[model samples]
Target: MGWRRSGHFASLTEDEEKKERPKVASDWTLAKWIMKYLFKDFRSLAIITLVLVGLGSVLALASPKIMQVIIDDVFNTEFIKSIDERFNLLLIMTLILLSVAIITAVISIFRTVLLYKIGYNTVKKIRTDTFTHLQKLSLKFFDTQESGRLISKVTNDCDKINELMSGGIITSLIDFLTLIGISIMLLVMNWQLALWCFLFSIPPTLLISYFFKRRARKAYRKTRKTIANVTANLSESISGVKVSKSFTREKRNIQEFRTVNQENREANMKAVAVFATTFPLFNFIASAVVGFVYFYGGWTLIFGSTAILKAVTIGEAIAFTQYVSNFFRPILNLTMFYNTFQSTMAATERVYDLNHSTSDVVEKTDAYILPEIKGHVKFEDIVFGYKENELVLSKFNLEVSPGEAIAIVGPTGSGKTTIVNLLGRFYEILEGNILIDDHNIQDVTLNSLHSQMGIVLQDPYLFSGTIAENIVYNQKDVPFDDIQVAADSVNAHEFIERMSKGYDTEVGERGSKLSLGQRQLISFARALLPNPKILILDEATSSVDPYTELLIKKALDKLLSGRTSFIIAHRLSTVRNADRIIVIKDGAIIEEGTNEDLLAKKGEYYRLYQLQFKDQENGSNGH
Candidate 1:
């Protein structure tokens, strides 16, 4: 069988579908999106960190002074005979350095806790917002996109943001702040050496900073893209494994997956190349500065009184040099972070675009409810097209009265489902208005309108839970007695009782534990549970066995009584008893009448009924 990729996605309005994506507010920068959106109460976390980090900085700066005092005071030539003085100074320096480490760790702990809050909360909001927007999006949008890609956006891509928020951003900033404090201390002790560092390291530091960020970003982008492809391939193969096995297409699928997997590997290797390069470059710069200091400072000491420049104190000089090396190291880390930042931004853009996508059908601000809708639906001179100068539906008109049963019969591409979709307010008409009880449907709140309707699709999906839970999906607060009554009405209660665990049994994934027919009956029961005024059955019985169809037919009669219904079906016999059967072809109404009326006319509907049901009848009788 050939598969076509056509979906409602392609039929989106040219203007609405392609509107420029909405953007995050200009004031909503990276920090604000993290702090404000994720953790509104960041003040406490921020203040605690500030206090501990401030203490850490002060203690660290005080340590070398203690070192200088011990060397010049307690260990001086005059005090050398006093062992007590030496011991006291040694104890003081130990406590000072130890205090710095303790304060630093305390601050680190608080920061880590805060970072997790930022990550966890942001992900929660992001997922919620993603789902909220997802629900708002018209069915057409999802039709064209790959489900796996959507899943990745929510799962893997969001995870990258979480990782960055948890540690990447916070640690990078903290390290940067620490580097600043150390540099200032070194400058206070020796401006000449500090000046050397600032001047000599400028060129190479900037070069590596720019190079590593850009190259690493390129690698990560490729990696993310490759991973998405791999995800899509996996979802496709796994979801359709039965078809693949039956058709013997395993080798082809494997070959395709391998190609994507290799691309992901190569992309990561390229990223590693840049990642590995940063360390060597960092070492070379630090080492070169060490040589510069030794050679330059030694010449000054030999030729002049370099103590005026503090160029000969062993501990102080060592500290100054250590500060210089330590200061420049963070730039390498910052560069790598920049790469992760870029990948994160790209993922954010995709998500933001989805959230911002304009709805194809926007409700009017002054719109009112279609009051007391008698279920009289009319498509008056309707015209629609996704693209300019091309129309899928043109000049279409149909009318149905209150509580009327209409069966729409058509071939594969006859636009049978489209009519149902429009009636349910899933899409907007391009030219004409769709009046429900003489009120335009576009004027009504979607939720208010949809609540009155129940739709059961060909493939009914049940969440992983008890059968009772699935039946009460729409109204959880409903009493158990009501649920049993609905199930009993649809003849589903008998089967539920037959199960080993009754309604409490887990349906497993997608209701896999039950036979397809049983699942359909359960879906029917669920839809009818709320007693919706409107019902739509689009191939609802197509996957069920004939015996189950018979049971469903009986249940449907009881459930559909006195309700407006549109049955989109290929099984003509199911709708043979409908009050009015309409035949549609190429987006136009070809014929319409009562069942006896259409069959008597001997037109499209008659021919279709003959072609499909004739074989079933012949097989039954062995004719």
Candidate 2:
């Protein structure tokens, strides 16, 4: 078997598939897309945040200048000979520092709040839009995708984008600005000292940053991919836990999970290793630059001549060293931003891919809404398959009249379910058209086509909620009396009412609290609640006990009344009561007629009937 990768549908074996990672859009492209969302609706909030950050950075630049003023002018014996005057100047500078600190603190609070708002709001929009787009996708898209990986895209990926918006982009921008501001201030204070510092600091800093940038990015991308794999593994395991236990495969499952978790840990450690080496190198460079600034500045102050290395003041050297530290601080922050940027790029690519995916079964642009159907349906020369160049239904044709009950029977893999799946427009037929009441299904809006039809699957799925809620799902303002009537019609009311809370009883996750037979009964009632014109029961009673099947059979007439129904069953007994039995083989109808007529023909239908009936009779005789 082969699988499709990402949003594109192409069949490739595990070994034939490329081992290299799929290429994504450049970081700049993805960053621009994220920025569009960040500012699209939250423009005002983003603008305010930027202004506050810029203002804070400017204030921070002023603090170092104030320290220089106090050291050089207020306390200098040569500049301030009078004690009273120096004291006044000192007090004034202290007050100015206090004022700047207070204003910066206030700005920090506002900036933090606004950044959070922008981050969460942007993620909320992306998450909401992604889910909405997912609903528009055809079943084919979901058929090829892992539910866990899709979930990771919506949740964990969006969260990564949030980390970038909340603190990464704007903070990095401000840090870069602060670095520039410190560089300029240092040069203005004493050019000679600033020139030497830049020579030793800037080149080494850029070199180290360049080295780590590539390594960290690749490492973080791997981390994101591995975590998504972990989530997918965990989700699949949880969903199949029952099957695992039944097969006594708990140990195997645990070992599999451990392998995935270890992969995640290794990927994270690789990223950590890159980060761990980066900071120390930057610190070493910063310390070396500061040390040289102190040495060179002291040399000029103590021994140097008049013209070339102009002598500097104690206050100036102190400010220059402080500015060197300030310069490296922003470099460190920018490094952190690059780390976040890499992860965001990885996540954004996935989320964008999912949101932009093309569905295989899209309605035409001018498609019309299908009016209430009378259940007349026709499949004209249908040809289809789940994968390329593989036809499950080839040149198949069928017509169903209003109020007719159809039982389509065939051996496994004979395309029985594909017929009904095509009828429901879950997958598009490659070669022909399916019409409902003479309106081509492809020409009708999917919502309109699906609205009048109800389907019950082999494994009936009930969402976690009260029984009443699941019974009346998506049917607003349904009365209790109507629910009770629907359940009663399916013989589900007796069991429901027997429970302590009756209709209000919780079904638990996927209706795990209920027995298989009970779940099928509930599914029957749910399908009939809307009084759909067309109903499909696909292996619906296969898992039920004899007594439960009898209950369903007793209600079958009422449920099948006045509706076009397609019953796809391996159990020949279920089809015996259908209006007509269709015996299919290899995507073609071998025989189809009333049960007795088909049985009289002694054809494929008869063979299937004898096999099932004899097995049942022998089982009873053995008991």
Candidate 3:
């Protein structure tokens, strides 16, 4: 039986074989996205940036100009006093330096605040838009994506962009302005010296930067991959702790976890090592530039000073060196910025992929919204599969009238739950259609179609909230009296009232504190409280004890009286009173009729009942 079950599990459905969506390209470029994404706010950001850059350039240029004055005229009052009555040199220097500092500080503050506002506000809007887009994605998209991966996109990927916004934009802007300022200052002092420095510097900066980026980008990719793997593994391990303990596989599990942990550490360290290597090299180049500048400028001022007319002074040379050194920092950052650009683009593609999926299953624009319904259902040549090569249900047919109960009994893999999934539109039917009240289901709005129906699943789900809250989830404005009435009708009120807080008692996550019987009752109350026109109880009473089953049967009679219901049950008694019994085998209805009619025919249903009774008899000592 176990081997057979394993074989059955290997089979995939036609729907599953639908082409998997392509992953976002790893080498995606951020340039196009940056242009498009920021274009809407470009005018404002550009105006602010230009204003800031102009201010920064003025400050950079002024630094050396002020120093030249301080060294020559402003500080050299003794030299100038012989010619004329001197103004207070110290007081003049103080005012000039103080004014420059004030302007620079103001510009820096304005740039910082505006950059932060643009970046953070853009990311916030992007996150909100992405999340809202997800809500519109058909279930098929989520079915293929791992929950952890989806969560990573929403959180980790968004977080990366947030960091980039906070510092990356401002750094780039300042670096660009500094580069411009440095170029203008160096040229004015000595064009020959500036040209030499610029030419000699490009090769090492470009070559080392290229290699460093290649290595760092590769390492970063590995780090991202490892993080995703670790998250997926951790989620699975924690979620299946029961299976781990039951099999006593804790040692093996922990060992496996250690392997993933070690790999993650290695990946992260590799990325860090690459970043560390490049930063030092970049610093070395800047130092070498300083050394060259000092060597030539010092010599030029002393001996070579005579070659040029009124050769550059000590303060002018000092200012040129400051420009040379300060300029390289932004150059280094802009050169390495490509690495972050690539990463951000890749994340964007992924987020967009999830947001813009065109669902294979979609209602037409002309689709109507289903209103209050009588629940007449028809499956006209309905067909489906989990994968392309494997068909689960083929050319199936069934008709159920309003307010009538029907049971679908089938062997495992005979498309029992698949049928239910199709009806719920969780998966699209490959061929044909399902109709309710002569209106095709595919031609109705999903929200309206689903609203008219209620489902109590085999493993019923109750979120972490009070029982009353869960029951009245969709109908929040419903009075507590109505909630109690619904609970009492389902016989859930008795056990619920036993709790200290009654309906207000917390269910814990997924109602873990409740007994199977108790959960089933609560599920019933939750389903019926909506007063849906159609109800599906898939293995509804299978979790209950005999006494609980009897109580549920009474409640079931009341609930099923006016609504069309589908009951998929294993117990023979549960289906005995169904208006019609559908005995299914190998994805086809092998036999189906009323209970007495099927018994008279001595067919599949009868044989199944006989087997259950025999098993019962054998269990009781010596029947």
Candidate 4:
């Protein structure tokens, strides 16, 4: 059987796509939202962090005061004293400074630890919540989103939030507080000199910061977008490597990847350039402040005549210079902090958008569990579409008796697979009802409904695990004997036992280590092990060789004996044994009956059967 490739629903224009993208809040708004949520549960940890920071800031501010005391009281004193007395005083001051430094270091260590705990734990919860939300979303969400973009949000975006919480938030707070404390101390010591420092330093610092903040935010935003593009490209390239090789498009793929990489590189360079220019400007302003202080204060001390300032001793001048350095230090650090804060805010906005997305398929509040369904299914006047004003299935109706087998055949885009999708509740119907055992599927819990249904798609997916684990997946505590029995029923046991590790053999990612036929058989065994009341085989044997196809047909006969099974097949021979054959066209059922009955009608199903099976029939006749 071959699949007819139908073009996807038309791609939306850029503007329309943007409109459909998740809405992101303003940076400040998102930051505040995250802060409130984080602190709601980590209030005590936050309080402890603040206390440690406050103590550390106080200790840091005391350094200049101690320096001033040493210079003014000991070095500049005129009182006569023994050398030993002088040494003892100096030693005592040095020991006090050492003690303060040690205590502050200890506090800083504890503060960092606490901040990390709060940051990591909060991010862990956020990541968990985001993943859980994604799980509840309908399959339609995945169809519209890129896997790489979604993966980036879960991993890269959360990491950025962690950076903000663990370091950016706490360090910025401490630096701001230290800036304020230093300003107050500087003014108390020498108001005139402090005035000189502020006049020269604050204006330039503010100007430089204002200029960089806007540029940095724009640059980092571009960087984030470029990185996401690169990630998306890489993911698609890896997943479609086989197709690329078959089409000899390796060079083209490389060129495409290189283009994305170049975009990312250019964006990073722009951000780096902004930082480069901003840092030097900050240093120049700081140096200019120091120069003004020395020139003005020295004139006052030496000449002892100035209208704007009082005369100062050498110790006071030295202390003032240290305070000047301390002031600009935080300013420079704050600039870097602002950059990190912007990046985090951007990431937060993305994460928040994903977590808040609404799922189209939602379980009703009063939905009840499906109690041991007996495989009777009904579709009444169904109307559905993947996009607005473009229905894939319209006014569709069907009824299946318990333990009956039905086969569905249609041209691609005739809404064949859509039936199974609707039955499985992967997408919600626009207008109509689907019932299992007379209970509306929408009114039943998804878990309870899904637990009783088994589906095997055209391309079987096997996660990274052992063969045995993949066979008994989700059916907990299934013994080896039961696994072997299921495999044997599907002709998978013979090959599995022939392998060195038997059932314990590892299947690499997506079962890359196994052939397509082997993977299908394993999937068949997996679905059968659960003994579901309803089984769906959508083109399940289409890709296998003739020998494997025969094996699958034999297995299907046994597996479908007592189940309400839906088989969607392109191969006419495969559906010949079905109790009923359904032919759909243009989202509507045109003909349906037993295989022989449909053939005798010489209608849509008859034409399709002839087109697919006529060549084989002719070959058989020649033989």
Error of 1 at 325 (Å): 3.2
Candidate No. with top lDDT: 4
1 or 2: which has the higher lDDT? 2
Clashes by residue pair, model 1: none
Per-model TM values vs. the true structure: 0.85, 0.90, 0.85, 0.89
Write the residue-wise lDDT of candidate 1 on 1-623 in tens digits.
Answer: 01012322223322331343243532135445556654464566555655655555455556565566566665566655578767877788778778767876776677677668767777778878888888887776776677767887887777877877775766676567767787788678777777777788867887777666556656766887798788879988999999999999999999999999999999989878877887898888988887776765686667754534446454555566666677666777766675566556556656655666667877688866555556777888888765557776898898888788899888887788888888787877788878777777888888767877788889988988999999998685988888889889878899999999998989998898999888988898888887887889998987788877888888777877878899988878888888899999989999999889988999998898777777786774111
Query: Across residues 532-553, which tens digit of lDDT does each residue of candidate 4 receive?
Result: 9999999998887677778889
Candidate 2, 155-199: lDDT as tens digits = 998898888888788888889889888888988877777787788
Least accurate 10 contiguous residues by lDDT in model 4: 1-10
Candidate 1's C-alpha runs over 4 A off are: 1-69, 72-94, 218-236, 247-274, 291-297, 305-312, 363-374, 386-389, 613-623
Worst ten in a row by lDDT for model 1: 1-10
The TM-score of predicted model 1 comes to 0.85
Ranking by lDDT: 4, 2, 3, 1
Candidate 4 total steric clashes: 0
RMSD of each: 7.7, 5.7, 8.6, 7.7
